[model samples]
Target: MGEVAKIKKFLAEARYHHQEATSVDMVNVMKQYKGLVSNLEPYVFNDGTCRKLTNLSGTIPVRYKGNTYNIPVRLWLMDTHPYNSPICYVAPTADMCIKVSKFVDHNGKVYLPYLHEWDASKANLLGLVQVMITVFGEQPPVYTKSKAPYPTQQAMPTASPPYPVYPGAATPYPAMPSQAMPQPGGFPPYPSMASETPYPPAYPPASSGYPPPQQTPYPPMQPSPMASGYPPQAGVGAGGGTITEEHIRASLLSAVEDKLRRRLREQFSQGTAELETLRRTNLELVQGKSKLEGLVGRLDKDCAELDKAIATLEEKEAELEKGLGKLSSEEPIDIDEAVTTTAPLYRQLLNAFAEESAIEDVIYYLGEALRRGRIDLDAFLKQVRALSRKQFMLRALMNRCRQKAGLAG
Candidate 1:
């Protein structure tokens, strides 16, 4: 088996032994060494590492002891086997060497150490080697064999037979062997050698020197019946034992006249029918046009009536507006006259009272004037100014009126 195949087989066994471990442990291991393993981490854990090594995967560079080491760690873990034990290695330098100082004692025997310095550059390389060994067994043998250079046998040339021909026919031949043979169920086969002419006996030589005869032109042909001495017929004569031309012409003229008469009758009948149809159509059209005219006239009359009604309404509206304006103007004049007629009597009664009674009478008259609708605002204001001017005159008038009436002032 191939080295890669054996390594894969070892890894499968190792993975089976480690199958009891949780997927998290595998993932943690891969992630911790991701700098050494790179993108293989997810596949190693999630895909169950056994399958990963079968594909002969790439390496990730891990640094240790101030040097970068390419560690061959199989992604797969293998079960312990007696014959082909799995093995992995970390190369200290480009050339792989084991450093004895970095070895760690496990169970009293020295095994390679785990890198614990936490210094990414100075750690154990043997740890990576041990991990690989735990996964894939030791490498397999390499085989070296070379292949032969060129092909041994060469192709040989062959000639084709002539095509077979039918008994009475000629055979046309191809010039070269590379030309395709005529297929069966196509044309007949070519001629055999017994029927074929020899190359020397085939065609005549060009130097025979005898010329061929020239061809003559053909004569024009004459009409047979006239050349056989048959005379031409005259008009109205029964020549050639047939009917006379005049009778044939008369029959033809009669047929033509009959056809013409029938055509004329048909044309007259069709004209009469067309006239009747046209009359009916004209009547229908006239009726329809009359109906349409009546509808149009009705529409026009209705539109005119609507227009008249609109005009009448507009005139009435204008008259009503004018009447309203007249009423509005006359109303204020009548109100003014009514106020002028009633207001003077209240003022006279207020002036005739004594001083204290006059104040009360003036207030009463002012209220009565307001209530009776006898005081316009402008006139009431003028009356208040006039009363102020006549305050002493009004007192004298009150005294006189009290004396005349014999009442205490």
Candidate 2:
């Protein structure tokens, strides 16, 4: 089949541009599109970049009502390979004027976020195209000629081209035969009362309960007293009797009902208009909510990354503090021989402190007692206190010992 060769050619082109594509990825593309596509063609751009095109004209699952039906889908791939996402449309029969909607617009543009966010580095061409096909299966666009909000509601009459009149239909009174037609008068000559053209029924049938009373053989003529004295009134009905007050009352009631009916229709039309406006408003709100939720999800992900970084920093701080503690805890400061009266005992203390394992038994216990007794005072004050008290005591003891030794000599 031509279609099969086209797919093979497309695969070859895809492999050519994407040299890094793995064998497994190529196999996946071939297997996935075995018979799903019905047509394929290729074209080149002005810059000589090759583009692949394909269409699945067979039954693609399209949803309507509560059922999914097969429909044709046309697709066009970008000339720049995976770098450009494909553009798709749902093409119905010639007689079908597709409805404009969220899924498919008047121009047949399909709305799918995957195509909108296509990334050449990540998205596989075969998989992305498959996604596009599956999108229509879930909730297909509703195609209707009316395409009005709340379609089940009453349809408001809109201006439209006139349709051909059918035979036997009540038509407007025809103009008098050319010879009988009036030239100067704005109105057409009235028809013969003797003829049977019961006035053309109202343009729109009367909505009131009662029918309009038939013409009483006269135009705007009231009963004349001279004719009332006789058996027949001048403008009375064919019955040739005096007109009664009841006829007048009945005609007046019909007029009132017709006026009320027209007003009711106007109010109904206004309400439907308002409902359409509200429907659009609700749609806009839904779109804004979706965008806001997407932003919040991104923010939450960023916050999680920041929290991990902060935790890593805290762990590093703990390790650094432990190292500093070990260095300071193990060493003792050396004192000058002239300043210490403790003699060789002070020298022995400094040498024992230098060897990490020298302190034991009584020596370790005494060192521990001295360490526990020391207060963690302010650095400047603690240093002053250490030097003044201990150094003064050691110096005085050394002077006394020297004097004693000299006396013995």
lDDT (CA) for every model shown?
0.38, 0.47
Best by lDDT: 2
For every candidate, C-alpha RMSD to the true structure in Å? 45.2, 22.3
Q: lDDT for model 2, on a 0 to 1 scale? A: 0.47
lDDT for predicted candidate 1 compared with the true structure: 0.38
Task: Please give, for residues 1-409, the per-residue lDDT of candidate 2 as tens digits.
Answer: 5544555566565444542343234345545544235445664554897755543433343332333344445656543455767676776554344434445654565766787687878876566556755665443432323233212323222223144322432232121122321123211233322112222211111121123233231223243232323333246662443334443444445545554665576455445545554675688789999999999999999999999999999999999999889978977655554345346654544443333232233344444555786544354355555545655554555555445545321
> Residue by residue across 1-409, what tens digits does model 1's lDDT show?
7433444444454364433332323334444443333122223333555333221233333332222323332432323211122233232222222211112111111222232122323322334434443321221011111122122323222122143322322321111212122122111232221211221111111111112111111111122222234443444234343233343345445545644654565356445645654565588789999999999999999999999999999999999999999988874556434543234544454445435465556756976896789887777777766665566566777667556656666
Off by over 4 Å in 1: 1-242, 330-409
